[model samples]
Target: MRAMDEATVRHVARLARLELTEADVRRFAADMSKITDFVSALREVDVQGAEMTLHPIANRNQWREDEAQPGFKREDAVSNAADSEQNFFKVPPVIE
Candidate 1:
């Protein structure tokens, strides 16, 4: 079984841009260790003829057919806009 240490957990947290307190780090370390142990146990399974599947039951893809449709006209669309220009929505600059 794997044992994920506090130092490893803190390092990973930093890499993922997470801000964890000391208590969080210690708590997560023990949880992560157990998770790793479970995954390690799964690696010892024997499945010589097992078929890979995303779910236990068979699945099917359901999709709607794509179709073109008429949309709002430019004049009528922008009529209610508080501010617009040349058939386009306009707003103040977000960045310099």
Candidate 2:
């Protein structure tokens, strides 16, 4: 990979729908170049036997068994609604 340049930075900004000034573009190019260099350095590391983990530390998930439960009655559920029809809440139209 090559270091990020002014043209590449401008292209990326255009693709992202950003409007950047010349000074901003120059600053971003330098920042992006540093990031690219860091990533290139990381590619040189040897990790053939390293285990992939989602997090830095090991954690156990707390799980619970699925169980059926009773639900509220239609009347009770719609009791607080300002308007309800056929056990469903009624709201003002959002679209024409």
Give the root-mean-square deviation of each candidate in angstroms: 7.5, 8.8
lDDT of each: 0.88, 0.92
Cα lDDT of candidate 2 equals: 0.92
Worst 10 residues of 1 by lDDT: 62-71
Segments of candidate 2 deviating more than 4 angstroms: 47-96
Highest TM-score against the true fold, candidate = 1
Candidate 1: RMSD to truth: 7.5
Candidate 2 TM-score over all chains jointly:
0.45
| Model 2 Cα lDDT, one tens digit per residue, 1-96 | 787989999999999999999999999999999988888987888989988878988888987778867899998999999999999999999899
Report lDDT (Cα) of residue 78, candidate 2: 99
